[model samples]
Every structure is written in C-alpha cells, then in structure tokens.
Target: MGDVSITVLDGDTLRSLHVSLREDTVSLTGAQVLDLAESEASRSLLGLSLPQHLKSSALRRMNIDGVDDDVDFRRKELSPEEASRKLNEYLSAIADELKDNPLVASNLDGSALRMLLEDEDDFAMIAENLFTDLDTEDKGMISKREIRNAVVNMGVEMGVPPLEEFPLINDILKKHGAEEEGELGQSQFAELLQPILQEVADALAKNHFAVIHNIKIVNGSELKKVLANEKKLNDVIAKIKQEKDNGKSGHKSTEIIKDFLEKNGKELGLPPSEANEAVILLYDAVFADIDSGKGASEEEDEFRKLVTEILEKFAEQLEANPIYCDLDG
Candidate 1:
C-alpha cells in the first residue's frame, strides 16, 4: 500500500472522514499500512476512553494473513479491485472487534475537577478532609511534603496522574515550594495546594493521559478452551485425581476438587481464589451448591464425571457473571 488517502465513515456520527497516510517514501509495506491503520484508528478515537490492551487487541484481530511485512508494495501493488476487497475485509474485522467488546467510556477532560475547584464550599470541605486524613498525629498542622500524599490521594479519578507515571508532579511540587521542610495549617495547606492542582488541571487539559486500569475480564473463554482439548482435560483430571489419592482419606471429593481449583484456577478461566470478596463468594456459592458427599471411594468413571460436572458448573456460572480481577494480582 502506497501513501494512500482514504475516506472512512465515522461510526458514531455516520459522517465521512478523510484519513490520509502521507510518508516521504513513494510506497509503504504491509507492516507500514497496518501501522498506519492502527495509528489512524487511535487518532480518530482519541476521545473514546479505551484501555490500551483493547486497542492492541483490535489491531491483532485485523486480517493480514497473506500480506507479508517484508514485501515491497510498490513492486507488487494490488489492482484496484483487489485493494478494495482487502480494505473492506480489514474494515469489517475492525468493526467486529469493537462490536465484540462493548465500549463504556468516560471523558476525562478535567472539567469535573475544575468544577470542584471553582466551588468554594466543596473545595474547602475536600481540603479539610484531606488534612484530617494526612494528619494522623492529630496535630494542628502538616508538613509541606505531605502535599505529595494529597496529590497521590486525588489520583486518576480526580485528574491527577500517578507520581511514577508523570514525573512533572515532582517539578510542580518543587515550583510550589512543597518540598521545603515546613508545616502548614489547614488553610495554608489549601492555599499552597490550590496552585499545584490548578497547574495539574491545566496540564491535563492541554495533553490528556489515557489510564490503563489493572483489571482483567474472565468469561469462561479459557475454560472452554481447556474443556475442548482432550489432552489438557485429561492432564487436569489426572492431576486432581492424584492429589485426591494423596490427600487425607476422610475428605469429601468436593473439598479436594475445591482445593485443587483454589490453587490452580487461573488456567481454567477463573480468577484467583482470594482475589476479592466477590471471587471468594463465588467459590463458596459454587462449592456450597454442589454435592459435598462425593468421596474418593467413588468409581474412577464417577470421579471423572464429578470433575467434569464441577468444571461445567464453573463454566456456566462464569459465562453468566464474568469475574473481573486485578491483572497484576
């Protein structure tokens, strides 16, 4: 694909928008075209609050099977008919990705934070609350350095980037004389903090940052894959059976299976057993509803059936109510 200018319809407004890929070179490679497409998509959808992973997933889902990245498009330029077909296929693939992943977006233009700042009563209440939280010693004043903590507490929801992400926060603190070793009363703290927050708000308004939440969606997709693979399913069952045999003899088969799942559920499309109260409740509810009287003394076929039944229950439950867990956790 050479430096081509194409017009694509805006999905939201149904308006035709021009997307031009202009490069210094006469022609682009397969990889270059893909890259341009991704860049254009991101630029056009900048206002959409999409997580980074979803954007990358959309690109990966694009159809580019036979288009070799190393091939020179200038020498093997596609005919107009072929190019049109490929373009339509790529567009369809992109649309499919968006359709599969429902979009829930929130525009972070610092307008909310600005409104709070403009409200004297709200701003004073917020400042007072922050002071009370930071002043753990019940002192009348807090160190100037505590402003950093205040900003951190404001966080992404309040239009403040993490200190580690935007090092400009440190510069803002320094400029506001927050680094100096001095204690400020609640009123003074608010006065000094106002300018710092104002600067942050201004910076965000000029150049917004996209926040990638550390959350993963689990919807039994991986469980379905494991169930589909005979080898993997056999391996899991064998492992569980071995563990059951090795475990204390008096334990119910359900308990043994629950233990195995708690320890090794990630591969089967389940979240960490102790990730949060909701996951813990999910585990409790599932196990509680199943037969707890099943013991190791059951026949081998019966044991396999029990395991399959348990997994199917999990799959059904997850499909209905997908669990969201911290990706890092």
Candidate 2:
C-alpha cells in the first residue's frame, strides 16, 4: 500500500508525517493516528487522514497551505487583543444577520453582549469549535438548516427551549431554517455567525475546564492559607535559600516540600480535596511573591529569592506531571 504522507504547515512550523499499511514500511493504525492527533506537535495533522475533499475543506478553514482553494492560512499566531478583534467582527456580522429575528434582537443584551465584548478570546475559541461542528457537510459553509439545527442542538444540550410549548418551538426552528434563500456560504456564516456568545457560554458551562476552575477556586484559597502558615513548609523553603546562597549544588527542595505536603497536608489542616490545590498554590505563591516582592520580611528576602529558584525548577516538573492543574490565573 502507498504511504500516507501528511504535511502540516503552521506558519513557519512545518512537520510531515508518513504512515503505511505495507509490511515493508513504518505503519500506524487508525487508532494510532487518532491518538497522535491529540498531541500538540501532531495536532494539526488531525484532518490529514480524512477523505481528500474533507481534508481540503478542513485545511482551508485553518488557512493551511497546499489547498487548490484561494483561502490563506499563513497567518501568524494571534495575540489576545487580535483574537478579540477578530471575534468582535464576527459578532457584529452575526448580530446584523439576525437583527430581524425577534429572539436574537430582544435577547442579545446583558451578559451575552458582555461575553462578545469582554471575553473575546474565549468567545472566539468557542465560535471556532461551533463553526466546525455546525458545518456538517465539511464544505465550510453553514446552511440555514444547519444554523437552525445548531440552535436546536444547543438548546437540547443546555436543557432549555426558546418557547415553553414544544411544538411551537419546533415550528420556530423550522421557520428559521427556511430563511434567506435557504443557505449561508462559508465566509458568510462560518466567519460571521459563529461568535454569538450567550449561546456559547450556556453550552460550555458543562465543559470540564469550567468545572475544574470552579473546583480549584473553592479549594485553592484554603490551601494557600494552610501552606502559608505551615512551619515545616517554611523550614524547607529557608533551607532551599541557604543552599543556593552557599553556592551548594544538588538540592531537591521543591520535590521534598511537594512530597511532604502530599503525604501530610491533611495533618496540616488542609482537606483531602485541597491536596492538589496546596501543591499548585505553593508554586503560584512562590512565583507571585518573587515577581511582586510582596510581604517579604527583610530577613526573609533571601528566603523568597531561593523559593523562587526552587519553584522555577518545580514548575518544569509540574508541567510534566500536571495531574490536577486545570485552573488559570
């Protein structure tokens, strides 16, 4: 069998992967391709094994090269502000399109508008995912029927209907699906109509990341206080500083502290739910204090500096073993 060669071009980052079913060549199963797609280095290769037409369509949406289509995907990574700008343009276009729909006209106020205006990065991410999901035909365009179907699907996912009467709501859904000459092209709907934020937020509330944030917020604060007061914890931090000051090599201070706390956090009054929170807070506090010089006693300045160094090493380990770290600062 001929090998499948997938080339991913993300700006200057180019990667090519080849797989074959032939015994003479290196081969990967479908399951392996799916697994590899979840990794960041290979993530852009996700659509490569799809049907040729579908792969072309997906790459066009991402603006990747090699497509015969006119779409360009050579853009640089967006800054948060640039992402916000792109999302806002989409929101404005969608609001214009649905201006005549009573549901959109009357309901596009308050938090819905705030998400579009303020949380643009998050809104844009949701919009991108939604656009991909709604474009069922893989043509990159969303038909009027697709838009209506998306709304209905979101309503079902969110467990709420626009109207109390089920049949009436179905009628409205069908009516909306039949509008404006029956279809909206890729550029028209995919780019313009996907940034509607209220719907995005409602649908995303059940997402795992949001749930993790809520869990961390509730538990991380208590962990911070407990760790701040733990005497043994401070002792290890002080030792880390002393060794660095003496130019001594080979110290595993962060690991010592993390392992100690992982085993003894409950004895220090932290609840079981806050064990991982304690580990995260310890690293966060070290970096935060070092950066801000906050609350460092004259005698403890060296301690803070050493703690910063120790935490820097600890952060590398944390990235490698990020078991419970799901919240953002």
lDDT of 1: 0.67
| Top model number, lDDT | 1
lDDT of 2: 0.38
Model 2: lDDT of residue 318: 39
User: What TM-score against the true fold does each predicted structure earn?
Assistant: 0.67, 0.27
Over 156-253, each residue of candidate 1 has an lDDT whose tens digit, in order, gives 65667678977877888999998899999999999998888888777767766655445566667678778888899999999988987785457778
List model 2 lDDT by residue over 44-120, tens digit each. Answer: 32212222333333333334337333222223333444433333332232222222110100111123333443555
Instruction: Judge candidate 2 at residue 223 and give its lDDT.
Output: 35
Cα-based lDDT for every prediction: 0.67, 0.38
CA shift of 314, model 1, Å: 1.8
